[model samples]
Target: MPQSHPFARVSILCKTYDPESGFNESHAEVIELHDDQPEAVDAVLKYIYTFEYDNIVRTGKDKTRPQFHLRVYRVAHKYQIPKLQHKACTGLDRACRKITLQTSGSKNGSSSEELFELIKLITEHKQYDHSFNTTSIYLVQRYLSPLMRLKTFNE
Candidate 1:
């Protein structure tokens, strides 16, 4: 039997342009990433890197074809939820440790630790992405004030 396909947990659809024809086009590819663990740091780059659009177009393969794009969307649609689950698991581990330490001892049972955990989890709903800005919101707001707005009236 044929070997099962190696799957990608994250994907990007690429639309490139043909300078000569002044036309834009689409294609897709599977991205293998290098990282410490599942969904950590978002190792998969964009999908445009893998295809040979110019070469294929020049060779007339695309000119005679109405559907030159590959069937990568199906794979992307399949694995997207799993990739998100992986990212959530990774972020939760970090946030949970912080919450645990921040709440080491609490007589009232409701503490800063609990608040922080709630905030971390609620904030995590914003996709828990692995971008530089995602990791360093303070740096972005401090250095590039115009790039962001204060989420609350306090600051």
Candidate 2:
């Protein structure tokens, strides 16, 4: 682990090759986190241990899948894991693609409607995700904006 990386500074004995376990003899070697979403937390752990998170989360045409990536992005931001944050953003964008998206709030809605909801979600979370200004959000906007224009023309 690189000393400059914030995550490298974390003292996880089993993971970091430290001689000390960090846990007292009576305490279990479990790490506790406060997030309510177990699946997202599991994805985070998978990424940490294996450096691959995409395969673990099989959204499988699920319309609400963007929320999973958002959860991962939030955790990454809180932990200052930039690469994971980027990956989560990529996942969100991929899920919201014109090919995969369903209506945002309804099963019978069109792809354009789903895309609209995704854009709304991105704007709503602009404050929490600092990278929105510098990276993926702009890419999302560039990719989706033209489609939005076309959608208006078609309607």
Candidate 3:
């Protein structure tokens, strides 16, 4: 791996690679993460190893599916994986588009619960100002704007 790689850049990974710590001596090949969601971790690993990920567009009844890309974006940001971050952004954009399409023709647009979840995800990414700002703007422009207009018209 290159010295500039995200794995090398992350302090925790750097510590694990330290020869003096004896961590690499005993488990040189294994890196164990205890407190992360398996799906998010898998997405990061997939991007790191393969430079790509499948199923960026999830299709199912799972209410939490829309947040998956956001989770990936958060993980990538935490790990300093720029490429993965960009990919996650693309995935997130796609997810937002999908959500917009799915809910567009409905009387009130998306369910309150679903919108709440998306809002929560957006809030979580607020520290990542660039991504958060762009995403929030996109959501407002694409989804909330039309919904608001509909409500205004109804009123």
Pairs clashing within candidate 2: none
Using lDDT as the yardstick, the better of models 2 and 3 is 3
On lDDT, the candidate that comes out on top is 3
How do these models rank on lDDT, best leading? 3, 2, 1
> What C-alpha lDDT, on a 0 to 100 scale, does residue 20 get in candidate 1?
44
lDDT by residue for model 3 (13-121), tens:
6675677778654455766666566678877876676665554334234423557877777778777887777777776766666664335476634664466457667
Model 3: colliding residue pairs: none
- The C-alpha stretches of model 1 lying farther than 4 A from their native spots are 1-12, 16-81, 101-155
lDDT by residue (94-128, candidate 2, tens digit) is: 75453343446766544655555555566666787
TM-score quality measure for candidate 2? 0.54
TM-score (all chains, Cα) for each model: 0.24, 0.54, 0.64
- The list of candidate 3 runs beyond 4 A from truth reads 1-3, 6-19, 22-34, 54-64, 101-110, 145-155
**Candidate 1 residue lDDT tens string, 24-138:** 4322243443322221222222222332223322344222221111112212223453343333333333333333212356553334333433344334443433431243343
| Predicted structure 1, TM vs. truth | 0.24
Estimate every model's Cα lDDT from 0 to 1: 0.31, 0.61, 0.64
Clashing residue pairs in candidate 1 (N, C-alpha, C atoms within 3 angstroms): none
